[model samples]
Target: MMRLRFLRPPGARPEKEFLARCLQCGQCAQVCIFDCIKMRTGFNPFTSGTPEISPRDAPCHLCMRCSAICPSDALEDVSIEESKMGYAKLDRKLCHTWKGFIICRSCYERCPLKATAMVLEKGIYPAITDRCVGCGVCEHVCPEQAIVTIPTRFVT
Candidate 1:
């Protein structure tokens, strides 16, 4: 079966290690101030109840509170720069600014790591940089739906 593409909380360990270490305790979900973290719902015993973030529905703010409260150490306590959530892929063809339809900074302006993660190319088009931690704010805020956040777990 194809697994759903979803991001783990910030500072999450690798997929395998994260699953093994996750206690399904729901603490991470409970502490999320943005309410972006949701426990996977289903009968799959192994993955059910695990915290997952659906960026388009609600992007993580990278507050790091969930990691701080996790008793199992599944999500490490790391700085915003070290979160490694994933990376945002921008489809310029669909971006208003990139296409020269209008000047839009929705993604660039909303990015938590503004100048580092997302940049304005030629003072117009939005560009994703390697420093992006893929918190998904870009994806969530893009009016043109031009940004997609590829979770780190699915990178390989």
Candidate 2:
């Protein structure tokens, strides 16, 4: 079955491997300061209670508290720079700046990584860079809904 483009907590391992390793404990959700992490609900035995993030509801703050409390190695205690949660992709067709109409800097302004992850190409259109950890802040903050955060598991 095809899984949705679900964003996992930062430092999560590969999707398949993570589902196998994660104990479905709510530890990560309990430790999150921003309350961005939520235990998966419903009756999915493979991943029920596993921590996930829905940027649309609330974006991750890169606090790393969840990883510190995770008992399973599914979430690694890694630096925010290496968290590799996901990557932001810009949809030029929907981007106001890319359309050459608005001077919107919403995505760039909200990106936690700032200049390193999201930057204005030619001092105008916002472009997603390799440094992006895909925290989904850009996706969450984009006024035009032009930015999408792709989970690391799908990046490869």
Candidate 3:
């Protein structure tokens, strides 16, 4: 998958270049405060060691846990914003609740971008809409590891 770079302000360096040096060992993923980062199998193998952020799947709250522990430059100094960061996408098929199993919607409850970001459907298994902000709360708290914050360009 091609690495995606958002528009940076003046004098800002390419985030991909920083991510290029990442080892993708998942060390940063473990230390992240908001659980915004995730590992991907396919994509830029060149920077495979780094974790990626998606606002809908896992939004970066700027807690800086991942960047704090990054051994490489993968998560170098960079500012995070709701609009700039692509959010998480949910796979209902992989979700425990969608599978007719009892599961908590912590992500839905913890979302900072409620209403517009996450809309709940009334059904036996409620569906979360694409409006989700991709906060890592669900992925972070999930015991099943069903959700992940995939790269925006690489998700398909």
Compare the candidates by lDDT and give the number of the best one. Answer: 1
Give the per-residue lDDT of model 1 (tens digit) for 1-156: 324878999999988889999999999999999999999888998999999999989999999999999999999999999899999999989998889879989888888899988888788878999999989999999998999999997443
Count of residue pairs whose backbone atoms collide, per candidate: 0, 0, 20
> TM-score rank, highest first?
1, 2, 3
TM-scores for every predicted model: 0.96, 0.92, 0.45
60-141: candidate 3 lDDT, tens digit per residue: 6556556556666444544433332344556777777777677567666665565556656663443445654344555555
The CA lDDT of each predicted structure is 0.91, 0.85, 0.51
lDDT of 2 by residue, 14-36 (tens): 88888888988788899898888
Could you give the C-alpha RMSD of every candidate to the true structure, in order shown?
Answer: 1.9, 2.3, 7.9
Ordered list by lDDT, greatest first: 1, 2, 3
Which candidate number has the best TM-score?
1
lDDT of 3: 0.51
lDDT minimum window of 10 residues, candidate 2:
1-10
